[model samples]
Target: MQSHARGHLVYAASGILAVHTERGTSIVPANRVAWTPAGFTHYHRAHGDTDIRIVFLAPSLARLIPDHPAVFLASDLAREVLLALTGPRNYDDTAPHYSRSARSRLLRVLVDELREAHEQPLHLPEPRDDRLQAIARMLYETPGDNTSLAELGKTIGASTRTLSRLFRDELGMNFYQWRTQLRVYHALVLLADGHDTTQTAYACGWANPSGFIAAFTNIIGTTPGRYRTSRQTTTSGRSAKSKV
Candidate 1:
């Protein structure tokens, strides 16, 4: 039921705000961080100031945190320690930079501090009832429908304000944020099925494909064209996982 966890978080400080999950939503703020447990449906974002840096730890490290949701402080020491990790480190034993002893020392410090930090849950402000679920599913499955809040509210017997609040509370996201996430997810599915962004955006109801592409890049860290190329490379590397 949470959005993130069982995945590592790296504190990359910069000023920008964006987070999207292939499934979950993201809430990015400098004061606090939200981490959800793995297979738990979550997302994260970087804010819009400048010089932003965040590193996602692998699932192996993420599993160490229990209870899924956590909020931690970006204290000076914590920040400094995390920042230290950004420097290049070597993994190969044969490389000149290899130093198992040093690597172990740094990792121990980083993990101990990170694990001991306080936890915060990424929360939705509204509650989700059957009505909201129905509407949400409809929007998700058919992004091109262009259903307005008024229309959806009429169908659900609630005021537009009520529905909007519900989205914020239960989903921990605003209407726009939630809709964008849904669009991004569908976009991914289309790309997976071999449709390009130009085709996917229109099919998904984006007024202009570029607009959708902009959203995709902001949330996903790359433009659709690059995303496809990079995805293909990554997929090829992991194709074996699909066979079994």
Candidate 2:
């Protein structure tokens, strides 16, 4: 990130996404876009079959916008503007329709769209109780296998009936719902770290990409690619800058 610069936005038409940070992990969907601040060490994940676009802006331009990281509501017009900006012509002054003047005009409209769009954060609650938390961690760390509630119950040294009771008493939501949300959260992170949909879906205990995307859309409000694109970061693997 350039000094005085902030973060960028990723536009996703379809995909599953996740971001992991020092703060925690967040999973996002296609219907929403994310704004990550500059200097935040984060990674993103997405489905393999997605056509995603990433847009980076300097801090000067970003400052005129809100600072908090939030998801922007993607309207048809807004989505079109984003798609256009992703094109080389959109930012080229020489292009008749995408001249410098046109770029500036388009930029203003895009910024307004961002500021007014509905915002939502991709977050989920973990069990607060020590016992439940332990169980939750185990389930999350091993999502690949077909580990059932009964299996988890044994690991926790509690009967399945007792574990079910404990979940209701401590977390409010039932066991299956809790697990679903947890998987969704993990799926996001896996995708952001460069894991493809097949890998992430399977890791999240999903049988296939379709199954994963189905849940991702319902829970995150968008497909994985769109979610990952919204929070797209700069290409971190670029050649290192020459020292002064």
Candidate 3:
């Protein structure tokens, strides 16, 4: 959805989700949830068939989460509370007063659970400076490009030394680290779209499958094959339920 005054939480109960904003992208797989603060323009796309849930937090409750966008590993209690709040035939305004009170209590519990939950490494930080943004745009458009920072710097009219400093100062990551993270993010989308491990590796600029697998596992907390398999299984189950 487009950015607005209200901050919102996006969750996927049975598949994968990717959230894109000015800050960067965050992946929300099963048992994970994403929060986007108010006024930041962001959009979401599901990787597979998903039971998607959206919750808009009032200003007070939104203050409990980060001002920027983030992803957190959802606690079991948090997931249950979230599902109840966003479930089928949700609580209506015309319902009894006690029902409203219960809804308020549920909202509070969801916020509390999220507050206690640890943030995951799912967010890929985006750079704000013009020089860095130019480089980022190039890399994002062609993830498989293996151009060195020095070479890219020449095209962008900056010295490697200058660009290196900018990366550290602005994005808190060195050139290689940031590029690798970007590649990993692209790999996630490609794999989720049904590309096999070898193809994904090549598409994301890794010459060797083993290297790609290692990097994917390091950032994503799971092997690409396993990640794709789980999403496929979830999508299949949803399809079956729809047909029944």
Give all candidates' CA lDDT scores: 0.55, 0.62, 0.80
Clashing pairs in 3: none
TM-score of 3: 0.85
What digit string (tens of lDDT, one per residue) describes model 1 on residues 1-244? 2344335453424322234443334343333334445555544443222233344455555656654444454556665544445432221112233275664555456556667775533322222477777787788668777778888889878898988888877777777776776677667656766688789999887999889988887765568888667545433322110000
By lDDT rank, best first, the candidates go: 3, 2, 1
lDDT (tens digit, per residue) of candidate 3 on 185-236:
8887787677899999999999999999999898778899998887776555
Candidate 2 ranges with C-alpha deviation above 4 Å:
1-4, 64-66, 88-97, 124-137, 143-180, 185-218, 221-244
User: How would you order the candidates by TM-score, starting with the best?
Assistant: 3, 1, 2
TM-score for all models, in order of appearance: 0.54, 0.53, 0.85
lDDT of 3 at 139: 94
lDDT of 2 at 154: 80
